[model samples]
Target: MFDKAFQRVNTFEDFRTELVEGKENRAGEELIQESRKKQKVDDDKETTELKQCLEIIPDEEEVTIDAIPLAVKSPRIVDWKIHKEGTKSYYQIIRADRKSQMYMIFSHMLKSFEREHLEDLYKLVKARYGSTRPVESMDYLLWNDMKIMFELHVEDEVWKLQQGYKVLEWKLYDSCGVHSLMMQSMQIYMLVEKKYPLTPPTLSMMLERSFKLIMKVKWLISCVN
Candidate 1:
C-alpha cells in the first residue's frame, strides 16, 4: 500500500524519472499493502466504535418519567359517635376531608386522651382548651359504666350529616354547680385507651415514653401495696 501511495505521490523524483514507477516496483510492496490494510482496519474500527457510542445514548422518552399520584398514607380511623350528653356544646370539631384515610388524627388523639381519662380526659382537654391550665396530671378512667359504653362505641356515625356541625357541651352536676373540677371527680371517668399524634405526633411520641415510665412506677407501687 505504501508502494502504491509512493507511486501515487507526484514527488520531485517522479519528474526526474522518465517513466512512471509502477505501484509494485519496490521490494516493500508487500509491507505497504499490509500497512494500507491496517489503516483501513483502524478506520473501520473507529466507525464501529462511533456507532456503538450513539447506540448506548438514551432517547428523550427514556430520559423522562410519568408523574405519580399522591396517595393517603396515614393510618387513622374515624370513630364518629353522637353526642349523648345534653348541654349546649361549647366547641365542636367538624372534619370531613373525603380523601383522608379517616378523619383528621387530631380529634382521635384528643379522643384517645378522652378514652384514657374518659370524662376526665374529655374535661381535661376541654379545660385545657377552654382555660390556660398547664397539664400536670391525668386521672385516667374512674367509672364502672365506661366498660359498657366502650363496647358500643362508634364516633363515626354519631351525628347525622347536618348542614352545619354541632358543638360539645359542658355538663352540670347534681349539686346545681357546673362540673368544674372534672379530674376531682375521679370516680366517674377513667382513662383506658389512647391514640397517637394529635397535633404533633413526634411530640406525642416523646410524651408516650415519659408516660410509660410513670405507668411503670404506678404498677410497681400497686404491686407492692
Candidate 2:
C-alpha cells in the first residue's frame, strides 16, 4: 500500500533522487487514514460514554406508616372505644389494665384540681378573652389543666436544681424549656395525626408556630421558676 502511494523510479540513481525529493512523504496517506480511523474510534468511544451518562438514573425509595405492619409497628394500642358526643364521634384509647389504677389516679387529680380552681380559671380566661363570652368548655378545661401541669413541672425542676441535680444543665437550654416541651411535642404529634395530608406551607407554618411556642414557654418557665 505504501509502495502504491508513490510513482516507481526508472534507475537506482533516479530512485535515490526520488527518495531525496520525497523525503517529507514517508508513510504518506496510510498514516493520515490510520489517524482518521483512530480519531473515529475515539469519537465513537466518547459518544458511547455520553449516551451511557444520559441514560443513567437515580433510584428513590418512599416510606409511609401504612406500609409498616400494625402488630410490629405499634404494639402499645390495647383497644379503642367510640364515644358519640352529640354528632361528633370521639375515639377513647384504652390501654392495658396495668395502667388502669394510674389512669384513675390521674383522672381523680384532674377532677379535684378542676373542682377547686374551676372558678378561678374561669375568671382568668374571661379576663383574657373579655367577659362578654363565657368560657365553659373542653378548651377552657384543657387550658387550665395545661397551665397547672406547666406550673408543677417548673416547680419540680426548680426543686431538683436546688438539690444539686444536674438535670437542668441539659434540660433548661436557651432554645427549649423542659416544663412544656413534652406538651408541645404531644401537641405537634396530635396535629400531625389529625392533619396527615398537610401542604408544605401548612407544615412550615405549624413547625414555626410550635417552635416559637416552645421557646416562649421555656423562657416563661425559666423566669417564673
Candidate 3:
C-alpha cells in the first residue's frame, strides 16, 4: 500500500510540472507574437516615409518649368564646316536656332549693349586675326581676363535661368556649346592681339622673318641635293 501511495504522488507531481511548463510556453509564444507585430508596424511606417520622401523629390532627367516637368531635348547641329587657308584651319558652325524655353525666358536678361559688345568682340577677333599664331604663345594676362569675363557672364546667365520656376538642364546647356563658343572667342582674341599688336614692328613681323629664314634654308638644302 505504501508503494502504491508513493506512485500516485509521483504521478500528481508530473502533472503539476507539465501544467507549469505549458503556461510558460504559452507566455513565451505570446511575447514573440507581440514582438513580431511591433516589428511589422515599424517596417510599414518606414516604407510609408520612404514613399513620401520620394514623392517630394523631382526626377533626375527632367526640368520643371512653370510648375510642369518637361523632358530635355537633344540639341540640333544644323551646319558645320572646316575651312583650311594656307597653314591654318578653323571651324564654322551654324547650329539650329531652336532655343530652349529656359533660354527664351532669360534671353532679355543680357542687356542689348552687352550683346553688341560680345558681337563686336567676335567680329574684331575674326577679322583681325583670321590666320594667326597659336594661342599658347599669346599674352597670358589677356587670356586670363577673357576667361574670367566669359565665366562671369556664363554664371550670370545661369543664375538668370534659375530664377523663378525655371530649372536649368545641364545636358541642354552643355549641348548648346555656349561655353565652347566663349572659349573659342577668347582664344581668337588672344591670338589676334599677339599677332597684330597696336605697337609698331609687332611680334608677328618677327615670326614672319623667322618663317622666311626657314624657307630659305629649305631652298638651299633642295639646291644642294
Candidate with the greatest lDDT versus the true structure: 3
Tens-place lDDT per residue, model 1, 1-225, is 998888768553654353435533563687888899999999999999999888554565456447664543222222222222353212222223432222222223343232222344234344434434333221112111233223323232211221122222222232211121111222112122433112243234435655777899999999999
| Residue range with the least summed lDDT across 10 consecutive positions in model 2 | 184-193
The lDDT of model 1 is: 0.36
Ranked by lDDT from best down, the candidates are: 3, 2, 1
Give a tens-digit lDDT track for model 2, residues 90-201: 4343433422112221233232232223333334444554524325444344444434443334343322333322111112211111112122113211111122233354
Model 3 whole-model lDDT (C-alpha atoms): 0.41
lDDT of each: 0.36, 0.40, 0.41
**Global CA lDDT computed for model 2:** 0.40
TM-score of 2: 0.23
Model 2 error, position 115 (Å)? 39
Per-candidate clashes, comma-separated: 21, 0, 0
Q: Which parts of model 2 are misplaced by more than 4 Å? A: 1-13, 20-26, 56-225
Q: What is the C-alpha RMSD of each candidate to the true structure, in Å?
A: 19.4, 18.5, 22.6
- Report residue 135 deviation for candidate 3 (angstroms): 17
